[model samples]
Target: ERFRQVIWPGNSTTVPKGWEIPTNGKKLIVGVPMKKGFFDFVEVKRRSINNAETILSGYSIDVFEAALKKLPYSVIPKYVYLKSPVNYD
Candidate 1:
């Protein structure tokens, strides 16, 4: 049977019934942008390889991921690309 689970932000332990709560910890998926810039936080190497594969690594992303790992709950990051400038508005 299929069950619906609703997760409240900042609430780690408590969850509705029928939801497969994380016994050890929660697995969170965070989005990250991979853009190349000399002073930017994350950088990506544009190369022609497997279409399903992407090459990305940087100091800022590494540190951020590390911090997330240190949290009490488990966090899984999902990187997203931001090609253009970010609009705050």
Candidate 2:
């Protein structure tokens, strides 16, 4: 079901002549920004179980992960914790 071409980093020739090489990396870095307020839009929560494992779950996170899975090729994203929401300006 994978309809996209898989090209590793530093190996651009694997891409088709007319196709553009996608981002290079086995795991992509995804930043999840959350506001300080407890809104439902983008709220990030971290849970620790006996200090063994850390788990992140929220409405925004679930949507982001689901979108990634729909891609034709494999894309594993490593979530980066942002202390505060991102400011584009």
Candidate 3:
């Protein structure tokens, strides 16, 4: 998701007059804090993808699902990742 710097009392392009509003470059810009490498969600997602790959090596999700099914529903996987339709030939 993109962060917007919509102006108050006006459209997103312009702010209201006589308003002592301060932006501090935070509303428009994307980041967590301290100007670290994670200045946006994309960087965070990329890091998570890399980390998951390392932890999930030699592990199959199907096996995990089978084990989960043997357990109670409360202990089963929550919010499973499902495939979505994509444009293809």
Model 3, runs deviating above 4 Å: 1-59, 76-89
Clash pairs for candidate 3: none
Which whole-number lDDT from 0 to 100 does residue 26 have in model 1? 45
Output the worst ten-in-a-row residue range by lDDT, candidate 2: 13-22
CA-lDDT, candidates in order: 0.60, 0.65, 0.35
RMSD per model, one decimal = 9.3, 8.6, 20.3
**TM-score of structure candidate 1:** 0.51
lDDT of 3: 0.35
Clashes of 3: 0
**Leading candidate by lDDT:** 2
Q: Which lDDT value does model 2 have at 22?
A: 53
Q: Candidate 1's residue-wise lDDT over 1-89, tens digit each?
A: 98666566666557534324356554455455543355366676656666466666777877987897676654555666556556424
Best by TM-score: 2
Q: Which portions of model 2 show Cα errors greater than 4 Å?
A: 1-25, 49-52
- What alpha-carbon RMSD in Å does predicted model 3 have with respect to the real structure? 20.3
